[model samples]
Target: MSFTEPMGRQRADDYRSAMVSSDPLMDVAAGLDAEVAQYFLVSARCGCFMQAARSLNVRPTQLRKHLALLEEQLQRTLFRFQGSALTLSRDGQLFHAQLIAMAHERKLPVIEQPLIRLAVAQSILHDILGRDLVALLRRNASVRLEIISLDSDLSLQAVSADVVVWLASTESPLPGPSFAVSEPERLAPLEYLPHIAKRYSRVTARPVSLDDLADFLLVQWQHERPVESFRPWHDIVDQRLAGVVQLHSYELMLEMIRCSACIGLLPGYMGRFDRGLIALPGLFDQSMQRQVWMAVKRESAGCEQTRMIVDLIRNTFHERREWFDT
Candidate 1:
């Protein structure tokens, strides 16, 4: 079969019966299908059916079949044939320009290098930063990311990681050249508290009174840094609240809050995003704002891959600061 052939009346009739029963022009007018357009673009680039087919790793006849489908959809001739040479029609030239413009509209991938090992606090991993982190990691096709979730103390010990994100009190900072961003450590009540006060409820919304905390169970994770260093927690410790309980894992602490087991202490980032958790703004103390730091080992600090990952974490948080508000 020749590469360019007239559409037989019988084939056109069959196509009409099988697919385009009514308003074929409407379907064609919507847009040229991507697969059909891609084939046409390849044909335009190669300037011949056989060469385009070879470049696309398809048979010459198969390429012609695709081009035929495109022509049928457009109801216009895209190519003109003279002996063995091929030339683009006016419609084809316009389409080729459109496809090139569409290609330019796409965003180029950002980071392109090797594997990056990143360790972050487990709570941070599952909370606000999780979705954005995953999306950023995927933008770079060549990156192979190994993400480890740990406590800040353990994360610091994970020297094997290329970069580490940890939450620390201003009193006890992470060791290294650190990009420290302060976010308040917030407390959550077992029930929802609106930001505005109502006469029916004693709980004041935005600046919740510290006295209201006495009514809820106080939950804490054993050996968590912010709790030990923050002064309000020390006050809570002094009182030895009647309902205080300690859990080993942050996940368990969150589940306890969901079940009304206790009022969970949450970092500002997680508290803002969790619909299930209500912020007890009364419990937020300015002196207790914890610093979230992204750090690397002194030796790896200058490595290009490590710097790229660290910069991404810092810049993304700076741009979306509202998500981490107390």
Candidate 2:
């Protein structure tokens, strides 16, 4: 359960010898056990036994024992521990690479598709990435995607998601050293414009001032309101709006606005999809803008599947630059 000392020169020699044994029978017969290989791979990716245990749904002591047994069988120290922190040794990295290759080779000939986990805000998923993801799946039947709608308090590290797309303001802080994160790719800020269904616009007189919003029902997206930065408008209209209906899903909010006599704020890009919606004039304030960003886990950054998803996301924002513009 304890690994206080670092791998020394003698241990390094033993690792190299085990990796390239002179006996061909020893090499072939002593290939890594499947279950133990899984333990080491997960531990290396997680950077610590505790986290690896949590990920594998096993006790830390059990995981440590399995790793220790694997090291004994190979005559190599695969991991080093300083205090409570665990890291893979250089030999471990080489072995890990070999294991990954073996895994990929085993999945050949249409057995299992590559799975990429994407964690994103509900609004973004509903309004933007949903359609794009559908298109991606249709084009590439070999790719499988697991889309997780980010909760207010969800941690990307906890979910083991490969990529994350979220509003910058609501992003979770970077995880600890045990988890590796790639540099974030910042996207253009999205502009939210007030939109009313044509049916609602027909019955109400459209005024040219901010005060006009006070007369209509304000349908607010749960995450975007109360537009606190735009105090002039927030104070005069949003806070004093006669009726407010808060919704969690953008799709539902759009339907509610389209069918009822209410005003809703939606991303400008959405206007292209719903022709029945009309933008309310004189309410496009700068405070309605929100920045968005995407990040990938370092472990998954080099994966081709992950790269494809990242490219798709970046392209989605790029193609809609005009919709996000202020």
Candidate 1, run of 10 with poorest lDDT? 188-197
Best by TM-score: 2
- The sequence of per-residue lDDT tens digits that candidate 1 reaches over residues 56-102 is 55667888998898787778787987677787775565445455545
Spell out the clash pairs found in candidate 1.
208-282
Error of 1 at 64 (Å): 18
Candidate 2 per-residue lDDT, tens place, 1-326, comes to 32234547876676556556654323522476777777887788778776677656567799889888777776777788767777667566556645665677676233455688888867778777889988776555446789998633334435668888766442333331125568776776765667888766764576456767777777766654433533443444447535878787677788888987777776666667677887765664455555677788898998988998999999998887786766
Return the number of clashes found in candidate 2: 0
Q: How many backbone clashes does every candidate have? A: 1, 0
Question: What local lDDT does model 2 show for residue 270?
Answer: 62
What's model 2's lDDT at 146?
A: 93
Q: RMSD for each model, in Å, please?
A: 14.0, 15.8
For each candidate, the alpha-carbon lDDT, in order, equals 0.59, 0.68
lDDT of 2 at 116: 89
lDDT of 1 at 99: 53
